[model samples]
Target: MTEAKAHIVAAVAQLIDEHGPAAVTTRAVAQAAGVQAPTIYRLFGDKGGLLDAVAEHALATYVSGKTVAEEGDPMAALKAGWDTHIGFGLANAAVFGRLTDPARGADSPAAAAGLEVLRARVRRVAATGRLCVSERRAVELIHAAGTGAVLTLLAMAPENRDLGLADAMYDAVLQSIVTDAPVRTADGPVAAAVAFRTVVPDLPMLTDTERALMAEWLDRAAGA
Candidate 1:
């Protein structure tokens, strides 16, 4: 993004932060950004488009600055990611709401990025032979649980909120999708398939067709 666009987005975000989403008019953002209202329209198309940009900018910026634990422990990194998702949702309620809205969410780059992050974390856990489910399933479960937890908490009065709810939901999700290192670790054959799936492309002595076929088989096994 250009400096001018960044400045406008930052200004709009600040306006929403200080005055709430309902108060953010094009004129207000224009005044705040020291630009004409038409500039916002010219750049963003309309108010909805502008709001979309703000949501994208907020999540992208937050994710860029977020730090997870140092490498080597994928579980720790996954836990950190869960915590970060919950914290981000609670802290940026408006942007979170915007991103989660059915109409906007389908087209939301921010929401997609968030899911991609979860996918990567789940893939790492799978690669470590710790995940019990397919990466896709794990991502869906965790994402749904996290979003539900945040929404549940957001629905309550702040003082009346149960701060432990998020953690509790996470624990439940982990119990459902994570293994405790049973006799067959990595959630058994399905998890093994998932772990192996990651390396299918790099397996030596395999033609492109063979690698593609192997990946397809692994995907079926993992999804089983």
Candidate 2:
């Protein structure tokens, strides 16, 4: 981005921090950025565009500070990711609200990226035979839980917020998505089915058509 574009994004972010999303007007941002209204228009098209830029920039900045755990328990890593997500939302409420907004949702690039990261983490859990559901299902459940937790906290006044709510929500989501151990006991069939589905595309012994058919059957077997 050009220096001017960066300036405008930063200025808009400051306005959001000082006030809120509703306070971000073109006139206010233009004045704060020391740029004319038309410059913002020319650079960002409009206030909506400017806010999008701010959200993307702010999210990326927050994500940069996150440390990806290279070695440890997969479930532990997943919990770390969850904690980072909650921290980001609490620290950047306006940007997080925009991300969780029904209309904006995954339409925002950052939100989509975040989901992909969560999917990869869920895949790691599935690979370990701990996932009780298909990888996709687990990801959706975890995402929904995390988003709901953050939004629920944000909706309450700070002192009134139940700090344990987020942890409880995570536990509930994890219980739904994972087994106490590797699915080697009574749930063996479900775990095997899910683990096999993840490797379906890599099965060179079978033709694409055969692999696809096998995947369909596995999908049913996994109850996905």
Candidate 3:
């Protein structure tokens, strides 16, 4: 994208972040971007189009920043990917909300981008030889659990919408799915953690190295 278009998109995102999606208006975006309102309409067609572009840009930027772990031990990579996914969501709450909100379904390019990311992750796991042909269902289950955990965490405590909370939720849900084990579903952090472990047993325990990588990825993703 050109610098001008990128700036416009970033301005729109900032507006949404500061004022929520309902506050986003063509005139407001154009003013924030130092452009004329007609320019926005001419380039994006409508307010929905601008929102869609922002969502798509955010998703593409986020997914592009991810490292996808290494080429070996798909399980390890899968765990790493889960961590990355949750971390991105926590760090970009406004953008994540805009992408996942069902009300935005008609214009949500981010949702489609997210599904593509999921499908690609599944394909990678399937290629690892760790899963049998009959285990495709397991892969799907794990993916669903991972996403579910993230959404659950966001819903439960908007305040705990940080990387730590995201990691705990993902780990709990992940363990449940992978171990076929029962997990607590109480209304606390402990319950969230347990749910994560139940769904994703192989969820990376995380390390300083991994955290450092995540920080780097976030820096790149935020265009900083």
Candidate 4:
């Protein structure tokens, strides 16, 4: 994306994050981005288009920041992936909610990309010999559990949003899975290696440029 387009998308994301999706008007985005409203319409087509763009941009941004080294133990990779997933959710709660909202449509490219990330993580876990048995089922369960935990946190406290709650929920879910796994061991390092091998490959892959852009985004998100 061009600098201009990226700015507009970032502006829209910020608007939605601060004021909810309902507040994401072209005029508002234009004003925030320091561009004309007509430019937004010309580039994005309509509000729906702009919304889709925002969603896509957000997902791409989120996926880019996630880093799991190829050489790490499987269990460590899984923990890192889980941490990144929940951290992104907690850091961008409103954006996270917008992606999952039914209003966005399940078939939307943004939603598909989001699901792809989860599926990729599952696949990575299966690549490790530790989860050789029932790998498919295990991946599916992990994805389901993670999603459920996030949604449950949101549902439980509609009025009070807490980043800690998201972390706690995901930690519990991950702990449960790790504890029950056949490969789990009493040794922390060994357990992490097992988890890392099982979960790292299941994540989305991004090019170097995408990763740099995502890193910039996370820096901005932190400062915001």
Best by the TM-score measure: 1
Across 1-224, the per-residue lDDT of candidate 2 in tens digits comes to 78989988988888888998888887798789998998988988877778778888988777666654546788888999998888888888888877667776566666666777887777777778888788878888888888899999999998898868999999999888888888664648888788778788889999999999999998888788
Model 2's TM-score against the true structure: 0.88
| Tens-digit per-residue lDDT, 116-220, candidate 1 | 778878877877766777788899999999989999998999899997999999999998877765325333887678788877888889999999999989889
How much lDDT does candidate 4 score? Answer: 0.62
Predicted candidate 3 versus true structure: per-residue lDDT over 1-224, tens digit per residue: 67877899999889888887777887788789999988888888888778778877988887767555436765667677777777776667666666766776645454556556655554454433222221334455655665666677777677655556556665665554343222233423232332232223243676767655654453333222
The per-residue C-alpha lDDT of model 4 at residue 161 equals: 62
* Model 3: residues with Cα > 4 Å off, grouped in runs: 1-4, 102-124, 132-139, 160-224
The list of candidate 1 runs beyond 4 A from truth reads 66-70, 182-187
Q: Residue 4 in model 3: shift from native, Å?
A: 4.3
In candidate 2, position 7 carries an lDDT of: 88
Better of 3 and 4 by lDDT: 4
Window of ten residues with lowest summed lDDT in model 3: 190-199
TM-score of 1: 0.90
Q: Provide the lDDT at 165 for model 4.
A: 62
The candidate 2 region of ten consecutive residues with least summed lDDT is 62-71
Clashes of each: 0, 0, 19, 19
lDDT per prediction? 0.83, 0.83, 0.61, 0.62
